[model samples]
Target: MESTTTKPDEAATEKPVVTRRLDRVFLELYNVAAFVSRFFKEVLMPPYEGKEIIRQFFEVGYKSLGLISLTGFITGIVFTNQSRPSLAEFGATSWLPSLIAIAIVRALAPLVTALIASGKVGSNIGAELGSMKVTEQIDAMEVSATNPYKFLVVSRVLATTFAIPTLTMYTIFVAMVGAFINVNANEATSFPAFIEQFFGAITYLDVFSSVIKSFVFGFTIGMVGCYKGYHSSKGTEGVGKAANSSVVTSMFLVFIEELLALQIVAALRAV
Candidate 1:
């Protein structure tokens, strides 16, 4: 005869696993919220790390230009290639530029740019800081009274926050260029005509909303990277883990933020 009954200790341990996980999740949420709060507080009350921020701006923004532009160009061609055929069937091919413009400005550019930044900028920040934390550089900076958090976290976050909007704007512009080239190649629309219609289709609200979304996405990317890096442990393995976590977490948060932003934009449009 076989006994199938579970032991009391085993049951106790099994029962607490889910509960413990939930507790850990809540604890993490609280910590992240606190981290963001401190960023805001310190950002305002500071001997502004202007030079560091500028350096990060170059590192995060200018360095990313080529990748972002290439992505935008490819996206433009693909989206138009897929969309134009369907639109042409409806005799609505004339609406391609506006439609693409709206779609790009409203969603595609923001999501793509954020995701790219998550992989590139987020991982870079996480790895750099994780390595610093591992090598005890952060501790040494603190002992030297250099305010490592400001020099590292604040500068990178602010640079990302400001840089994303500029990147987003550039993405849209380059994407439009690709779209125009496709349209000219396929449908023979003049560049000037495409440009006129593209700008015409864009509204103040669209620009404003897109910029706002970029700021939030950028902040999320920077915060997750900084947070993961700042708390990383277990040495070399920890640095890899932090960088991986930064990209995954930033991407997850970006999607969540996108959904929320859509809802907010819809509500505003309704009003």
Candidate 2:
């Protein structure tokens, strides 16, 4: 008796694992671009959902303030405490206020705010939309001659797009306050002096860059969350997956935006 060896089917292994993953990534990117384009189209052609947008503003902005404020304060304190030793070694400890201001305004505030919003607002949008999707509430809206995408998706996306920038500015202020507390404790720096130094260090370019970065981050968070939720499947399990995906995708995009923003700003400054 002779034993026969069987060869694996070529068709079954036509695509390698890496190739399949790359395909999936490109497909996902295409879907995201399409989703974002649709959002822009609907937003411009709307009998705008004013009331819903306001309600979402309250939900996304106001409800998140307490948490954002706490996080900002803690971050400022920790960063200042960490920087003091390095500055002292160079006899430049007096630069603490200016340094904190630049750091917070240029990078820290926007990044921190975006990350927090991604975790909080992103997940909320994803879960809420996903639930509606899976429960057929979205379909029901269509049956009743309602535009669910406008009522739900547009409002929430707009809310996040606008709310996050406001939150970032607030975080900058609160973080400065926290930094001042540390500075005052160490050097007895007056509040007015700290404020003056902070503003003196921050230029119009810095503020502009920060606002632009925040807006980009906000759009990323909202768009990613909406896309994940709107496309979610697999029933209730998909809701959880959408929420998790929203946070992770938002964070990844935010970091990418931050790096790009920095490069652009640096290039402008060099000019």
Candidate 3:
């Protein structure tokens, strides 16, 4: 054959990668929504698995403590040191301890811990479920008359809901201790005074708003991780993709939820 000359229309006819991404996004969103709804339905039904749920509780809660605390400690110290000089330079140094402590308690501690845990827990959930999906284990469970969603997905969602807030609280405590160390580095704020401001800034509004936002964040992250893993289809590459997408999606959802939560809290306060 002679030269196959491309026409102008043919040259311009490449499939839009952006369109494919949007399609994938919608498909995944639909699947995850269905999975979450199934989770609630399975959860409310009787004949629950106490042992599995307990194991999930331990896995999600206890296993996360070390990383959360370590991160929290560093967060506290660094945030304190970083935020101090400017305030000091402006003669607002006395506000440092309480201000930093409040920031830790109400926002930074929970959000940052969630960010780190999203990388850890979300990736693990995705990889683990992806492996199961690839190995046909999830399918086998279905064939055996088992509700895998109840056993695997719902339990994790529940565990994350309960665990993250407590984990965040512990993170906040340790972060304050780090802040205390930082405060004493170049200034003379007492620990007790710092504690006072911490509690004083903590209105019920702040406490409830922060805790609720984190719980929602945890639920979104855990469910998204498991959902991605459970449905992974690209074999080995799917596992990696799931883990990466879970973290990225959960982070975006967390920020979105933060804006939504702030709006809801403000509305509630106005009532």
Candidate 4:
């Protein structure tokens, strides 16, 4: 019953490496950068896709809230347990809530949440876009008169821009709450004094800078993930590569941003 078609394995599976390197790495990065630039260019233009942006906002931001909260809870409890003994040795077990709040609010919670978010949302963005590219959906959108880049990239990027700071805010709040549980685990600390001391450590300046840095972190994460996914090649293998690369890149960027932000925070403190 076989027709006279060549066996599937008879076709060469290997591509000439040099010919593909431009597409595989260099052009891919260029294309991603270009796509992000184009997104910003068109995002403020007329005929805004408000509804789609909202949907993306919910999907990207609100959906990730629970994971952030759960992680915050665990981080608060474990961090306090581990650090309390040292502070207790100094007879400063009383400083537990104050210390935890400053660290969590200013740095730890936001940075760790972003790291986890990259693993979750960044990979999801990459795989989703890579799959769409593989399935010809982006091409089909173009044929249907849709600006696929605007329709796809802008909404998602904007969502990350807005949602991540919201998540950071939430993470800070939940971490303090969980730390309260830790404070009570040994002996109840005065809730009012604890609250006041925690808030004392948080200057408006610190809050403003921390929040702004988180937004930048979110934007970078979204851009990298969406860029890789939207330009994925070679079907399933390419999609997998895009997802892996997105998480790796986002995690690296998160840490770099943390270092930069900490330096800025220090400088601001000295002023």
Candidate 5:
């Protein structure tokens, strides 16, 4: 009968495999923290890459406008349509504008905008940087006395950080417009009345919290994309992986941040 005991070599190798994986996980976390710290450091002390940042802004924001607009409009219409029956059942149809406004302004707008940006902008940054990494272009930039990190990572990150909030504001406006269309059709609610209810339902705190959440979400998306792409390996395969992982990671982080932000906002509101 074969021995039931594990061979010494097999046992030794098994332990190391588990240990190595654990070590790799922690090492990856450490590297990410360092990368984030470096970004804050370099971003503040800069021969600022103004042109690159502007170019990235155009890439991230302007190019994404059509998709964002369409998504926001659709979301508003769908949400309003879905909400109407519930309100109507209670004879509270008049509250549709305020309900939509609060729901969109306080939650839906920021979340939808961030998720869209995470897919579009995050994947683009990851693919772009991953390609640069694999092609040795980044190395060449370093050899040519350029700070590649500043020129590439910082600029893209800054672009996302700023562009996303602006996009969120646009999303809110577009979504509100869409919701108004649905409301108008159902109740003949005047646009002016809808607009008044929309603004009246939202407070300074709601706006402030949404903006803060957008900023955090933007930063998380940008940083995750940059980190994944910057450290990518294995040539073209790695570039694809980087882009895919950037989207996945950014979306995950956005959800986590959203949850945390809501908790913090709740706490603040309670005060």
Candidate 6:
């Protein structure tokens, strides 16, 4: 018989908790993937949200023009100014146009535009949807037999998907203009000379890759924002959390997409 009191092993006790947390993360990821899949499926189904999509497109694209343009111009100026000293040291000042154009077209413009939109559009969507959820507007729509998901989620997502590429293109043009002005201020480079070399360095492949990446970035931002908002809970606190999470998640997704896009671009170039 005897005194058989067993002590609990801390390691063994913690293992299950850690495993459950990991499982929860995996489950959340799966749920998000499923939500995105549902969005695509719903998008293709009846009662297309043409009008709402157009409206949201204007909201996401036109409303964002000023911010994007200002940031793009500033980016160009700062980038050129920073690189000039290095280029001058290496007797590569003449390469400025090509470098600026290539960087803007291939990476900077799209990345900056997407990030701005994620900050602006992502937060707006998340907060708007979260508020609607909290106020029961979404539920009321369902009660009235209106397809709220289509009107709210699909439209916004599609608008962002289409608008971001347009914004990226606009950003590239504006950034180039900024670089051109900055170049002239620093050197004897003429507008024509700058434009010639700028366009010369940029290949069709670069433009295509940037456009594709923008599309993906836009989709990711819109979907994540909507997902966060749609699932928001905990009353008003949830709305704030949703908005914050949307920006963070969207930015993270943008970087991930950029990395994958770069790999794809490299693979395509090799082919």
RMSD of each: 5.8, 5.6, 5.5, 4.2, 5.3, 6.2
Off by over 4 Å in 5: 1-15
| Residue 106 local lDDT, model 5 | 89
Residue-by-residue lDDT tens digits, candidate 4, 61-173: 88898888899888888888888999989999888877887788888877977887799899999999999999999999999999887888888888888888888888888
Where does candidate 2 stray beyond 4 Å?
Answer: 1-23
TM-score of each: 0.93, 0.92, 0.88, 0.88, 0.94, 0.92
Clashing pairs in 5: none
Q: List model 6 lDDT by residue over 1-271, tens digit each.
A: 9758776665556678889788879999998989899898999999998999999999999999999999999999999998899999999999999999988999999999999999999999999999999999999999999988888999999999999999999999999889989999888799889989999998999999999899999999999999999989969999999999999999999999999999999999999
Give the per-residue lDDT of model 1 (tens digit) for 1-271: 8888867676556666889789778999899889889899889977899999999999999999999999999988899889998898899998889888998999989888999999999999999999999999999999998989899999999999999989999999888888989989988999888888888898888889999999999989988999999989969999999999999999999999999999999899898
Per-residue lDDT value at 115 in model 5: 96
* Worst-scoring 10-residue span by lDDT in model 1: 6-15
Q: Candidate 3: misplaced stretches above 4 Å?
A: 1-26, 268-271
Candidate 2 lDDT for residue 77: 93
lDDT of 5 by residue, 15-97 (tens): 76788789789999999999999999999996999999999899989999999999999999999999999988999999999
Instruction: Provide the overall lDDT of each model, using Cα atoms, as 2-decimal numbers.
Output: 0.92, 0.93, 0.83, 0.85, 0.93, 0.94
The window of 10 residues in a row where model 3 has the poorest summed lDDT is 6-15
Relative to the unseen true structure, what is the C-alpha lDDT of residue 161 in candidate 5, on a scale of 0 to 100? 91
Superposed Cα deviation of residue 90, candidate 2 (Å): 1.6
Task: Report residue 160 deviation for candidate 3 (angstroms).
Answer: 0.9
Residue-wise lDDT of candidate 2 within 82-180, one digit each (tens)? 999999999998999999999999999999999999999999999999999999989999999999888898999999989999999999999998999
Q: After TM-score superposition, what is the CA distance of residue 24 in candidate 6 from its true location, in Å? A: 2.2
TM-score, cand. 3: 0.88
**C-alpha lDDT of residue 256 in model 6:** 94
Tens-digit per-residue lDDT, 31-117, candidate 3: 767888988888889778778878877887799888888899999999988887789788998888768866887789779878877
